[model samples]
Target: MTLGEKICRLRKARGLSQGDLADTLGVSRQSVSKWETDSSVPDLDKLVALSRRFGVTLDELVCGEGDAEKEHEPEPLPAAQPQGRQVLGGVLLAVGLLGLLLFTLLWGLEGLLLGLMFLLPFLLCGVLCLKVRRRLGLWCAWAVYLPQQVYWTMATGITWRLVLTTPHFTREMNYFRLFIGWVMLAALVALTVATARSFSGLRKEPTPKMVGVTAVLWAAALLIWRLRALFFGLFADETGLIQLPGLVTGLLQGACAAGQTAALAAAITLTLALLRGRQKQTPG
Candidate 1:
């Protein structure tokens, strides 16, 4: 292959457009285009930069003597082995459907509602088992988990008034539920990290900017969660005391859960970016 062909192939392999490559090389897209078309050649300094960017030696880049064409040939991707995950996904889907049917028959509308709430996560889990790329499935699954209390109240025909006024809604029960919420939050973070690492491309170190963004997102989320009491104060009664209605609190709590999930997602993204950056810096 000619030098221009080599540059073209290398740029494509890195998933860069002429504009992107130009930005990195501190040159115009036209320059890169000209280089790729052999209408012009990069100077020695630019050549060195190109070699470094593509992780190729100067000799190999210029002389095309390193079996460059053969080395850069696209390899066939292995076929997916879907038997195990597909079977697991199918089983979970069946269980969710079965539960929906059973509950609808036994408890009528209320049971159906409850079953549907429960079914969402199981169905998503099944999708996750089938296709790892469906990260939104995991998010949907977790979203259902976040509003469990709201769903419980609705299913049991319990009013917000009863929850607030009744003595049975003890502080201890609230604490227990808070603890569970934290546990779920931790699980979400862990799952997000695991999912990011599972993808081969995300296993590299991240850039400093990415790390900063992650830190900022986490800090913002924590700040918001900590200021929940202040926010509740906004909905206070005439006495200037915080007095949240049950449904409002439930909605706020669900929003908090979603925010926490988003923060964890940002953290996962930073982790992957950091890994990619580290890999780039490391010697092969």
Candidate 2:
């Protein structure tokens, strides 16, 4: 291959766009583009920088010499965590679950579910460690899901308020409640199924079908949630009048849930677009 051709290939292999390469080498993006298109050659210093950055020797970079060691390199292993990491993850998750159970026991098995909202951060870490085999996009979903969950839990705990059992109940109100409940439940189930399929034993990543189902369910939930605010509004005062702050918080939570689902779907789509699986990068 020509010098410029080699630069182009290496740049692509490293997932570097022209702009990315340019920024790294302190040059204009146009220069990088030119080099890639063989319109111009990088200088000696620029070549050396490229060589180091791309993990290629000067001989390989300049003369297109194949690295004998790299030619016979092993194929990437499945994207699985190490046994020790898995054990550590299991321990962390066990601690969180047991702590939650302890809170359940201490809080009378009913009232203090929210009291252990303090464990949110630790549980989040545990989840990350335990599901380390999951695609990168899944974590974005978790990020979106956690904060609203924390807020909702803490708010309910502080006010000692339950979302259900209204004195001013109507048939429409009941239907609305059921709809929201079902949609949220279904969305959660879909997401869980998707997550379960992300493991190496079942699948390397979630199927597109699962992602589509999840996105649709979450979107439906979001739409129903907004409709609730439009018809009944989210907040209530002592006299059952609409309250602005409550409505705002309610809408914010709904939006957050939907956004989280969208982020997950988008992230996974990007990952799927790649030609290869998520593997530990060899020193190529």
Candidate 3:
């Protein structure tokens, strides 16, 4: 079939008169008739518009020989932006690895340098995750840092006091591990809430009081955990390096302690984000 014949067939199948299709496209009915009669072709822009309006690919609409399999198939979106994000993520990860090597060489046998090596990548990944808007970028950032979180959660949570107090523990007394885990958990919760709101198409404004209360809870809990650890450190054996458990065990323990706070804060923050997203979706 010719392009003209295909257009006529599709238009009739959609139950649209030439005048109706032309009206939908903001063009003259005579132009539609002319195209159906093989008088002239639509401009490129018009062709795209027609393709969209008729739910057909540009190929299917412009040429009668469009494949049946390709007719309703949506074209794959361009990956230019995602490719750039991946490159950036790769560079950041490499820098982190380089930092680790340097730290290891400079501070041999003193796990402090190795600790810094572990931290740099997580910090970099967190920054990139927050800065990049694309899902691919966010996930890439997470992938780089996720292992660290798992390691910390397993190390610290299984025996919170061990990772928090030991000289061989993360140099920051488990603080870095806690902080990174919380950040990642928060992002996950926010993403979840945003997705839920998008699908439901509902918006709800979170009160400032709610945010303030959550902050207060977070601060108070953090302060108390730190103080408790300090007092415990004073009484415990100070010389030996405690063997901390793996990532799974540690995170479970951490979740039992301060992990809940981070998770809760994440849920609240995500809910607020979802509310805002839904509001934007609404017509002004």
Model 3 regions more than 4 Å off: 1-78, 109-261, 270-284
User: Which residue pairs in model 1 clash with each other?
Assistant: 204-275, 204-276, 205-273, 205-274, 205-275, 205-276, 205-277, 206-273, 206-274, 206-275
Lowest summed lDDT across 10 adjacent residues in model 1 is found at 157-166
Question: Each candidate: how many clashes?
Answer: 10, 0, 9
Query: TM-scores of all models?
Result: 0.46, 0.35, 0.32
lDDT of each: 0.65, 0.56, 0.57
The numbered model that scores best in TM-score is 1
Alpha-carbon shift of residue 238 in model 3 (angstroms): 14
Ranking of candidates on TM-score, top first: 1, 2, 3
Over 215-244, each residue of candidate 3 has an lDDT whose tens digit, in order, gives 665565456456545644554456733344
Superposed on all Cα atoms, the candidates' RMSDs to the truth, in angstroms, are: 9.5, 15.3, 15.5
Against the true structure, whose lDDT is highest? 1
Worst 10 residues of 2 by lDDT: 154-163
Residue 54, candidate 3: Cα error in Å is: 14
